[model samples]
Target: MYMLRKFRKVFSLIILTTMMSLGITAPGYAAMLGTDDILAGDNLQQQRDYVKELLNRDEVQNQLADMGVDPLEAEQRVDAMTEQEIQTLSSQLEELPAGASALGLLAFVLVVLLITDLLNLTNVYNI
Candidate 1:
């Protein structure tokens, strides 16, 4: 037991000495952010979240798909975009009408389908 205790003490002392000689510093605790930093972090997070939410809309996803762009790819691209680009997109989304007047768009689609059916381009609905 004495020999085991002595060996343990020696091992601990060696580790301490090696660490001191290597100048190994303990990791620091995080510092608190200033008001400006806090506000900036909040704003950036809000912008990123806003852009993500806009991309999640069914209309936006469908539009991207129609343009031959994968909606998932578009979302990933948004993450790689610059802060200015994100801000611009977010602003544009805010200014645009939600879902771009879903009823109007649906009506237009129905009319186009009807016309195509008449032209025999499509025989949907047997119209």
Candidate 2:
């Protein structure tokens, strides 16, 4: 009877520890960014920069001051944009550019190589 009581005590302690751990971690988990953070962050830098660039143009500086974006923060965010992101800004302003179809291009090239091999078109084709 004593052994059984001891076993039950240990099991209860384990379950209690797990529950405590979860409760302690719950607030940290809640602070995490979700899907909305991801989508919003995607354009965060661009929006910041657009505000600055437009601010630098005629009369927009006063507009930005009215909007409460600190001039330094706006400048910093603009400078922080990566080169690829800057390129995206230009591309986004225009219609999407034409591009090769990845799967189609891969298939087309593979077929052409196979046909060339079957025809023994190159000295490198052994059989």
Candidate maximizing TM-score: 1
lDDT of 1 at 66: 71
- Span of ten consecutive residues with least summed lDDT in model 2: 100-109
Extract clashing residue pairs from model 1.
none
Clash numbers, per candidate: 0, 0
Question: What is the alpha-carbon lDDT for the whole of candidate 2?
Answer: 0.50
In candidate 1, position 81 carries an lDDT of 56
lDDT of 2 by residue, 72-108 (tens): 5445544654555444443443333344232232233
Off by more than 4 A, model 1: 1-19, 22-32, 97-127
Instruction: Report the C-alpha displacement of residue 26, candidate 1, in angstroms.
Output: 8.2
TM-score of each: 0.54, 0.28
Among all candidates shown, the one with the greatest lDDT: 1
RMSD of 1: 12.5
Pairs in steric clash, model 2? none
